[model samples]
Target chain A: MKNIDILVDNATCLRGDNLIFDNISFNLSNGEILFIMGPNGCGKTTLIRSLCGIQHLENGCIKINNVNINNPECNFLENLVYIGHNDSLSENLTTYENLEYLNKFDLSNKDEFISNPNKFLKFFDISKYKNYLVSELSQGNKKKVALSRLLFTNKKIWVLDEPLSFLDEDSKNNLIKLFLDHITNGGLIVTSTHIDFSNYFEKSKYLNMKGININE
Target chain B: MNISKIANLKYFYKHTKNVSKILSFITFSLFIVGIFWGLYIAPKDYLQGDSYRIIYVHVPAAWLSLQVYIVMAVTGFIALVWKIKIMEIISIQSASIGAYFTLIALVTGMIWGKPTWGTYWVWDARLTSELILLFLYIGIIVIYSSFTDKRQGAKIAALLAIVGLINIPIIHYSVEWWNTLHQGPTVTKFEKPSAHITMLMPLLYMLLVFNLYFVTVLIKRVRLGIFQREKNTKWMENYLND
Candidate 1:
């Protein structure tokens, strides 16, 4: 099978009576990082959701590996992971239990994460809270737990919405390093963030929501 | 297991917690009174004698059991079509209660049959169909609990319930339709009830009691199911936190 490339062509999304964004397009290849930077309410979340096939695109074609992404037969869904703005963790479960439960559905290697869960938890600085109920954790810690799920999955395309919103400075740097490591291993990382990541990714493209322009 | 932790009737109603307890208590109380009146107070049947007393509990139980299934099936349909989380929860709750009542009816019928027909069990049409209903209830509950995706499980269970409903009418009408050894409809059709007004009064009262009892248990189970499904929701957090 040929490796896939994701292309969003002339996409437009609407929220209520207002047009959130129009004619948004981009192409992402393997071993590349595309940083989506936009101010609040600029439809960065909307664009990511549309690309992940969770939201309806008013007018656009998302093509992956030369096949229409929206086509049910393409099976693009199996190759992508989209973590939304909301923390989808079940609060009743502990961090370890949550990760173990999610790992069952992951298409990636399970043994790596299963054997060294604390390594990832420490990387996110949540090692002490590993056994704590998610309901008891702070918002930033909860976001870290949610992000850990991404590390457990082996999906090629990672679509994240505001992943750095609640992380501390050190945690943010660790996440940037993790993203860089993911792309270095021939995976694609598409994330929406307001924080400046220019020092980390040299070739990352930036999109400004104010004028609706794509930057390189 | 703590009785105090089980949640009392007033507190349960206030918090909408464990509503089934109160309902079950009221229904069971009515059942006790009805049983005493039907078996001991009412005169022995002119033809079947004391054996006819079984009709009071057996017939009502059988009727309510089928009624509960229909209610469950309807809720299942709503859950599947509308994607209503509450409907799915209620459907699951009703399934267990309905199954229990169906089992009670089957057992009581067998007991009454031992002395009258000289057999505790038979492969008669009504009995067989009721057995099938019990299996359908089990199938629904099992399917719902097995899947991780609550919505998907509810949809599948709802479809199964609807399909199983086809057997309900067959269970009810098997005696009249197929000329089976089992008796035809007694309390349902008023044209010719086998018992007089004195016997019928307590039976009707017991049926009403059971109806209220089913509603009470249903409310409690629905509440528990809702708590399980909505535990992750923000609303649940607010409710619990407060």
Candidate 2:
């Protein structure tokens, strides 16, 4: 067994003059699920943003496989996938093109995924919107297009922020199934959600950002 | 430290409150002096007479049209590479402001051309390249707004701004490299400005006014934009109260 998959130590973030959250620490391993459940505006989004390396931490560090993710010598980028609270889709590009943009940036196992984008369009049941500009698609369809990036690669860590907010019931079930498949394939997921996805991942544990930790 | 970039947007707004007020005062006062000097006080062209007064406005507008694009491209490079949110806002505001000034330069040039060059329009390299520069600004704005997610919209606009930088040099050197009705570089000559002291002072004054005006507009527009984007957030509320 690996010693650790993700190690976050004393992660601190402050908003304005107030501390939104501080001294957050956690650990997770492959095939394990870490669900960050907090109330709205409780810094769930900020924490997720910090882990994805999108938001700078006021203090502390995050390491993947014992190498600091922020370190110049670390090669953790190829292994991390961050889906922010926003869909972050370029509406000018078609759904397929949006998927292709992220897929082209993969540093490893690049060639195998080129032919599979259309297959992924079908997997997310968003095939009809493949040629349509992402702006023209419905909100749920946009989320699906965003989620399709997960299908195109085998990234090790999935950092998702409020992923289930706009998803339909069937899409939610499809997402749960995909999560199970990803974990079974030795991938780790750290997600913040208002929705309870515990029924889907039985072993999933919760981390509260109110300076309290409740183990599963 | 790759993701260690910070966006002190509120900080900018806080500090620029007094600066923007001062700049607006200075730029407004200068605009009055510059227009009055160029139109009523400065000497007219020896050849074109009264028509050449447009140079005070046309030349500075055209110059800034290119300068602001450079700002956008530089900001785009930073935003894309470093993923800084403040740089993204600067790039977006720059495109709108650049496009506005590009339109001003084009219209003033055509008005100036009617008397000097015998026609109001020409398809010469410099004019066409400047037209394409307008198109590039439009493209960035259109593509940026097309995205539902404004942050991703910023990324797309940043890419377009960076790609559009190729046209800047073409617009700058078009008169020198190709035959064009537009006059050659006058105030910005590599060796020295060729204009007489009588004609040069007002153009230089307007250039300063144009640059200061750019800062004034950028500070106000970006502050308003950040407020809208960060609506209902604690930082924004605090900023508004402050």
Pick by DockQ: which candidate is best?
Answer: 2
lDDT of 1 by residue, B1-242 (tens): 11232223223434665346666776778778877887788887776678778878788889998899999899988876654556777777888999999999999989987775668876566677777778878888899779776655776788888877876676557644663444444313223445688888878877887788788878877777666654564556776777
Expressed as tens digits, the lDDT of each residue in A51-74 for candidate 1 is 888766646678888788778788
Expressed as tens digits, the lDDT of each residue in B27-122 for candidate 2 is 999999999999998876667779888989888998999999999999989988876778888999899999999999999988987886678886
Question: lDDT value for candidate 2?
Answer: 0.80
**Candidate 2 CAPRI grade:** incorrect
TM-score of each: 0.50, 0.64
Candidate 1 docking: what grade? Answer: incorrect
The best candidate in terms of TM-score: 2
Superposed model 2: Cα runs more than 4 Å off: A8-25, A30-62, A70-72, A77-204, A207-214, B1-7, B170-194, B239-242
Q: Residue B239 of model 2: what lDDT? A: 58
